[model samples]
Target: MDKIQRNERLSVIIKTLCDNPNKVFTLGYFSEMFGSAKSTISEDLDLLQKTFKKNSMGNICTIAGASGGVKYIPSVSEMDVRETLEELAKELSHPDRILSGGFLYMLDIIYNPKWVNKVAMIFATKFSGLGIDCVITVETKGIPIAFATAQYLNVPLVIVRHNNEATDGASVNINYASGSAKKIQTMVLPMKSLKRNSKILFIDDFMKAGGTSKGIIELANQFDSKVVGIGVMIETGLPVKKLVGNYHSLMKLNTSEMQENNSIDIKPNI
Candidate 1:
């Protein structure tokens, strides 16, 4: 490959590193890929890291150990956070977007492992020093992302089901008002999943009025657990006051700017 081609190839490799949070690539691997010497590969990685940081995009982390490698971490600044959130809000609020029965069709976003992994890594870093012992989420959709976060933090996950099904093996059920219905619904969490005085982080796919979030908080109380923080993949901006506070979100669904064909232009808030 020509010099220009080599630079482009190096950029592609660096982008891949940024996309996978928990993935680490060794210098030997890159050296073989580009048919370049170890020193040349190292210089390319160094240039990529400096260029990325100069653009305020993120950072490249190097691990030093027998099995160490390089990894890219997303760390957008505070100003970028606002701008990205605003763009996401516009995309989410489009008129074509339809939400049925208080639930938004945001599974496409949450099910995306790459995007969700990036989000969890960012949250794990921000809350690493906050004394968090575990991560909790209401069952089904939020399970995958919550599991990812727990995996990153090396913490156990507590799932809150919609009801006490026989599968849960003697779960605890509680009645609480739902966000849209304004009526009571049963929420269940399996016993023995958490312990007393442990700090828990709440993770959910989406948040509207936060009624379910509040229910999780109450459930946590049964075990003498304290909710350290709340996080949502997407938050629909509404007039209703949120029940569970201390929250972080990647994007806000304004629901006024959603376009046709389900293609949403999401701006990264974090």
Candidate 2:
């Protein structure tokens, strides 16, 4: 076999790290894979680490020990995040997207892979350091965002069902008022989806009165897991008081002016 040149090894190593972010790979693995010496692999990793930092591509953490290895973390700059969200806010603020009862139509953006990936990047950057066990979301529109986040964070995803289904056996259900509508609704989670005390991050497409988030909090409790953080794509401004506390939103929507003026108030959370 031809010896792998430094440039060739570097490219493959970067791809490997990016593909498996947050997963540790020892120098031994790389040495064997590329038929290189430990010293050479170490040098390559060092250069990759510097490149990641210089380009703001994220981080390559080095752990030293018998079981030590390198772990990749994906990140985006604050400036990039601000610019992206500002643009997204404008697109979502269109008057035609407004629905009855002050809710903005977010299905389009959430379903949009390009937009949702950016939203996921924002959340993943915010919560990546939290050592999250999994990314969890309630069923429906939030699935895409949560899945993307889980992908970047290199963690598993757990999706809660809005209704208990026969397919998912032994589910834990909870009742909470639907946001803004003030209608009581039930949501469910399966027993096998989570382990006790698992640190989870709850993500969603929107948060009005924070009812769904609150209910998600309770649902997580049934599994004895803790929600370390909560993130939403958009939140309502009218019902200023939210049932849940200490959460993050990508944008705040002011619905009052939407109907009459065909205008919207979108506040950037970045």
Candidate 3:
């Protein structure tokens, strides 16, 4: 076999690490693949780490010990976070994006791969230190972002549903009051969805009064899990207090003004 060049090895290494964030890749594995010495691979990783840090392109973390190797830790710099949120606020502030019920039309943003991946990176970066076991969200709109976050965090994604599915087997159901509408809503999670004593991270597209987040907390309790972190793409401003505390939101939406004036008044919360 022809020997792989240094540049070729570096490119493949960066691609692999970025593609599978937070996943450990043993040095022996890479050494065997590249037909190179472990010391050579370590030097390459050092170069990549310095480049990533200098360019603000996340991190390449090297794990020590016999079972350790390297992994990508996705992160957004403060300047980048502010810039992204500002751009999002601008895009969502357009009058056409405002819906009838004082809700900002952000389905397109949350569903778009470009935006979804970026926002998910922000969420994953914020909660990266939590030792999160899984990322959880309700069914429907929040799935995309939640899934992306789970990918970055290198954990499973758990989805709670409004109704139980026959295919889900036995499930645990809980009713919690909606923070915005003040109406009761049912949340369903399968019994086998989570293991006991797991730490969960909740990700959602929007938060009115954090009813959904609160519901997620209650549901996590059923499985003997705890919600260690909560992250939402956008949160309303009216509710000075939310049902759940200690959440990170990228953007703040002024629903009242948006409803009254038919214009968006949103800003970055970072």
How does each model score on lDDT? Answer: 0.73, 0.88, 0.91
Better of 1 and 3 by TM-score: 3
Give the best candidate by lDDT: 3
For candidate 3, what is the lDDT? 0.91
Q: Candidate 1 — which residues are off by over 4 angstroms?
A: 1-104, 256-270
Can you write out model 2's per-residue Cα lDDT over 1-270, one digit (the tens) per residue? 234498899988889989987889998999999889998899999999898899888898889999998889888899989999999988987778878865577788999999999999999999988989999998888999999999999899999887888888888888888877889898888888888999999999988899888888888888888999999998878699999889999898877778667677888885
> In candidate 3, residue 123 scores what lDDT?
91
Q: Assess candidate 2 and give its lDDT.
A: 0.88
Which pairs in model 2 have colliding backbones?
Answer: none
Better of 2 and 3 by lDDT: 3
Query: Which candidate do you rate higher for TM-score, 1 or 2?
Result: 2
Poorest 10 consecutive residues by lDDT, candidate 1 = 255-264
How close to the true structure is residue 61 of candidate 1, measured as C-alpha lDDT? Answer: 71
* Candidate 3 per-residue C-alpha lDDT over 136-178 given as tens digits, one digit per residue, 9 for 90 to 100: 9998999999999999999999999999899999999999999
